[model samples]
Target: MTHQVHLGIALERAGWHPAAWREPSAHARALTSPAYWRDLLRTADDAGLALATIEDALSLPDRFEPVDALRPGRVRGRLDAVLIASYAAPLTRRIGLIPTVTTTHTEPFHVATGIQTLDFASRGRAGVRLVAGASAAERANFGRRDIGVDVFPASGRVEDSPEILAAFREAGEFADVLARLWDSWQDDAIIRDLESGRFLDADRVHRIEFEGEFFSITGASIVPRSPQGRPLLTVLAHQTVPFRLAAEHADLVYVTPHDDADVVAIRDDLDAAADDLRRDREPLRVFADLLVLVEDTAVAARDASQRLDEWAGEPLTSDARVVVGTPADVVDAVRELAASGVDGVRLRPARQPADVVAIAEKVAPILRSAGVLREDADGASLRTRLGLTRPESRYVGEKVAL
Candidate 1:
């Protein structure tokens, strides 16, 4: 049997289509409100989606909708990925929640613990998609000295400059530290033997004294015993070093591709990296990221894309675009991608209601009927959903001489 592909939709309250907000089916205020997310999660759950990825960013919507005219960088957003998972936890029973977090602004200690909390809070249905801070704009938001949007922003700088490679290395190191710290507490540490008034077996907890060029964090999280142990470590890599980081640390990686050729090349890169790392990254699910704008008809969707581009004061993206199409068309693209070593596709619709509802109602069913999607959501936590087993902590029994 062919390995079945999974379907995941990134939620932004509205659907993924840019004109989706204008569509009668979309809800206006939900894009920036918690209630909006809750409603959508339920929609995905009802549609039986495998996962819902919530994007965490300081800036949002890029533009606005009549529903809720967002003054980009002004209107506060709904709760971020972790909180979204917590909010959706009780409402929907399945649907793995993967939230994107920037390793640049946050300390590994904080993220490591918070993700673990999600696992516990959501009953082991938490995953964090890690992305290196790429924009000077984003860096500025966090008050960090950042780089511009161009690839490897400082690649040719003659003076002291942080290149893209360095940024990824730093982010990789950050993930490394998070993994180590997560394992710093052993699984059996929670021996609540109240008879002796000892809540924890101290011998089970390990300390990680990780010191890298970028950072050093002492081991042992304030919160211990996460349900999934490591939850799910994922990184979206569009370049080399980040790709390598995914090979080393990420259980699931999201890759960007211009087309089929790009997808094949990335698959080859990951295969080579897996060989170098002596890790089985081959079956390491690579999910293609697409900014979608699905519509009832291709022509209408195309025109809508054009209109949205005009609104943004620029043309729709030339590359990495999953333009207007029907559910069958989207499935064809998804099937081709899966054959090219993509385990799935994560869609970011310029939307709130239409794209998401369509994905769940239309795309997911098409994928399922085509024998490509998971048949059911039972026995699926974020880890198992991505096919990763429990990870062994780097701090299990070693003491660094440093």
Candidate 2:
């Protein structure tokens, strides 16, 4: 059977391009409004896309410059990603809402409960993209740990810095705590029995008591076991440190592979890491990230990309491979990626609503017809849709000795 590739959208304020806000079709004035996110998410859901990952950060997009000296052209400001996902949940039924949550500054307990609440709200359609906040501004916002100014060096290689690597290591521990907390409450822990006036079975809840280099949690989660046992854990990895983190903790790993060979190489690295780590569970899923600008024709797409680049004062540059073409071109690209062994592709649109509409109306139908994209199964949870089984709680069989 041909492997059906999962499709997702990485939603930014207006779009991924720095100058996307200047576009006539961009919702520049309403970036924080509920209607803007609602429309975009509804489009993705209706398009039968598998998931939508909301981008977030504690600091503004421009990390280097002072807030007062920030450039005027780029878009700025965003509401809380978890809150946005919760707001969009009722409005969208099918697509998984995976919001980015920075683990460096935020406490693991808060992250665990917040995502648990989101999972409950979305009825198991929620996931979180784990990220480590590295900027001094973001660190200042929390007034927590002090990181060196040169954590992100001139070479643009993040893993080269020990501080950054340590942050990722902390994030891995953060992910571990989140998972343990999610499994703290057994599935049947809650029982509303009027006869005995019993609200919960105390025996069924387990204290995780997780102690690590970054965090130490000593009890069961305040929140009950979520619908999927644990919502999906995801990480966007570009190098070895993050690749190992994803292999060890993430259910899904998003990778920036510039070409087919890159895809194969990344897959090999992930597999090797998983092997070295002695991962005993199901292998994590890999999704290649693409920054896309699709139009009616190749010329139209190129023209649109050029226009955006001109507006931005530079050509579009992304960690992911940039694709500019028509629906057929996109389909061919997806087909190639599938052949290259990627389980999915997360497309970051260069423009809002316009590229979103194109992906839904034009691109998706062609892929579905080609057997590359599968139709969404009605009423399926995000895990079910992704072919992941709902895991039983680790504390299920552990009963309190009388």
Candidate 3:
């Protein structure tokens, strides 16, 4: 049987299109408010989507030129992604809350503890989308050395400067240490024996003595083992270095493939990387990311996207595939990609609430009828719902075969 097509929504404030904030349906000013996020997440929960990815950056959205900062109808600013996910966790029951955290400037120790807390808050439904790269402006905010985005090429081929490679290398190490820290506390470490007056087993908790080019850590995380041994680690990979990093660390990886041919090629690259991985783990779940504009019909959706671009005063662009169609058309496009071995697609709704609602009501049914989607809220953890097993801690030794 074909694998089920998993679904996730990329919850960008004001939606994917820049002009979406100007749309009547968009509450532009409420993008940072907790109430706004609760409502949006509730929509996903009510619709039974598999996951929701909240986007973030160290810097505000702006143009290269300073004057363009004041451009009207262009959305700008966002709340902290991790905080947003934490705020939404209680309001929604099942959708996985994966928030983007930049590995470039943030410390690994902080990232480890933060996501672990999010997992506890969400009861194992938390995932982290590790991002790399900090613009000069963003670096200025943190008083750190600037890491230029130019090192990452548009063609997905790696011809990077030492600085660029170092940035990705650091990101890879950050991901590695995060996993170790999460598993530093063995699942059986916490023992509440009132008579003995001992709460934890010292031997069960081990130090993660990790040393890398950019980071060095000896950690036994303060938090206990999260519900998912390791909250799902994921990365968005476009080039060789990032692909290798994703293959080495991520449980699920997101990619931007324009068509079936693109999907096949990228999947081949990722498969090769995974096959050569130093560690033994399950094959990576590769999800293609897309910007979707689903309206009453395909033509209307295209027209709407065109209008959004016109309003923004330039052609709207994105790293992911952009699909303009009705819910049925969107399903067809997803099916086409799935036939070429794509595990699933994470959609960035061109307009939020409405487009996402349409996906739940229309596209989900089509997928469910075809056995491409699981029935609503059927799993205990995000890992289970995605058909991933709860991984044993890396510190634990493998069982000896009989």
C-alpha root-mean-square deviation, each candidate: 4.5, 1.8, 3.4
Model 3: colliding residue pairs: none
How do all models score by TM-score?
0.86, 0.96, 0.93
Task: Give the TM-score comparing model 2 with the true structure, all chains together.
Answer: 0.96
Residue lDDT tens for model 1, 57-143: 644434112223554422344567777777778777777777878777678888888888878877788888887654554554566
Task: Candidate 1: list runs displaced more than 4 Å.
Answer: 1-3, 13-24, 58-78, 144-161, 278-283, 395-402
- 1 or 2: which has the higher lDDT? 2
Please give, for residues 132-238, the per-residue lDDT of candidate 2 as tens digits.
76677776677776773334656777667877878888899999999999999989889989999999989988889789998888987899999888999999999
Best by lDDT: 2
Candidate 3 positional error at 198, Å: 0.7
Off by over 4 Å in 2: 63-68, 148-151, 154-156, 400-402
- lDDT for model 2: 0.87
